[model samples]
Target: MKKSFKLFLFTLLFAYQFSAGQNQKKIDHQTLTWIRYYNVLPLTEKWALHSEFDNRSFVNPIHENLFVIRIQGRYRTSKIIELGGGFAYFNVNTQNPDADPDYSIPEYRTQQDITFINDIAKITFHNRFQLEERFIQKADKNGLLDEFSFAYRFRYRLQSTFTLWEKEQNSLKGTISDEILFNYGKDNKRNTFDQNRIYAALRYHFTPNLGLELGYLKNFQRRASGVDFYDRDIIRFTVYHRINRKF
Candidate 1:
């Protein structure tokens, strides 16, 4: 399964590169900071609730970029497989940080995912595949809200983590992850390859239930025009918390 999944991802990536062609792509470069919080609450041995809050901001002039909230229910079917479904809300600003007044665009998304976990030689790998239904509020030339546009997105992420140092329950670890996204539906006109994200982080665990991560992420995205792209560098700080209980 892992080999097949890797082959599929490589094929998709090849297609994206081939489609890019020789056209001189216009790129917009920007720097941003992201703050995030993640929580996991166990309802039972096999059921859990996961929640996330994220805030993003532009760096140079200090402007808000995006805000997001997500909630999901996860069920562990076995030691190595989990299934999850979730809802997410997003408030986004213009991708151009230099816009006179940053307008807010709202989006609602519902998604489902399956995750496979593997442990080999003390390194743990997670492979996650997800599908999303997105409803984005459109805007007119004057930035007035219009009817919503619907789209479907598919995402695949591969992540790996290994212990860097360990003493009792407190430890430090390094993580690397990559996610690729593709878009489909009537609303997606020019591009099927939406974006790709690459991230690396150092995480510190204070206890079994709490941890902190500092990471850097690079996002490369193709716009609706297909000729325009965004290259974003982001600094991210995250807090992870877990609560275990039964009701």
Candidate 2:
């Protein structure tokens, strides 16, 4: 176990070290802000529907970038494991709002994910593996937009949540998470290293089914130029809720 852990740490360090040393002169920096909403509707003890939305904007000047919505059907197999399938739709635009010939894109994706939860010592940990099939739109030579390109990506996330205080349905918690993504498929011509996200948040559980979270996230992304990268800093606000009835 110790050897495997050391190997994982070594790989992570090497990857980041390599990325940090690449295209130092071409790195782009951006600030972003987002508000996210999450919901869960439990139909039974083992089945649930989940949905989420995100409104994203670039900060430091305040302009819109994208909006996204996703829906999922989730099945809980046990206390420690769950599986889900979802679809997401995205309306995305480039940074400029008034640019002539607006470059707005509509995107679609289907996703599957497996979630695992466990506790080590006193800290609670959650791990997720997600795979996505993406269909992206592009403007054809005739100047008509068409969706004809496909892409695939795999993502993994590890998160730990620690309780600060708890009393009945009210509590405070802190969480930290790291996620990495790799992309493939026919349409993906850029770097294989897609993105990495690091996040930290504080959450307040006001009721058994509702919570609010405020967080900070840093995103590192490989650009289409293949060598250049961007560092995006995001300020996040999220509302999460669950709806369930006695069954």
Clashing pairs in 2: none
Candidate 2 CA-lDDT value: 0.82
The list of candidate 2 runs beyond 4 A from truth reads 1-15, 23-25, 95-103, 140-144
Tens-place lDDT per residue, model 1, 1-247, is 4663584478457545743662577888899999999999998899999999999999877788889999999999999999999999999886677774436889999999999888878878888899999999988657847699899999988888889999998999999887888999887878788888878999999987899999999888888887788889999999999985757
Cα deviation of 118 in candidate 2 (Å)?
A: 0.8
Please state the error at residue 247 of candidate 2 in Å: 1.9
All-Cα superposition RMSD per candidate: 2.5, 2.6
Residue 197 error, candidate 1, Å = 0.9
Q: Give Cα distance to truth, residue 178, candidate 1, Å.
A: 1.4
**Best-fitting candidate, scored by TM-score:** 1
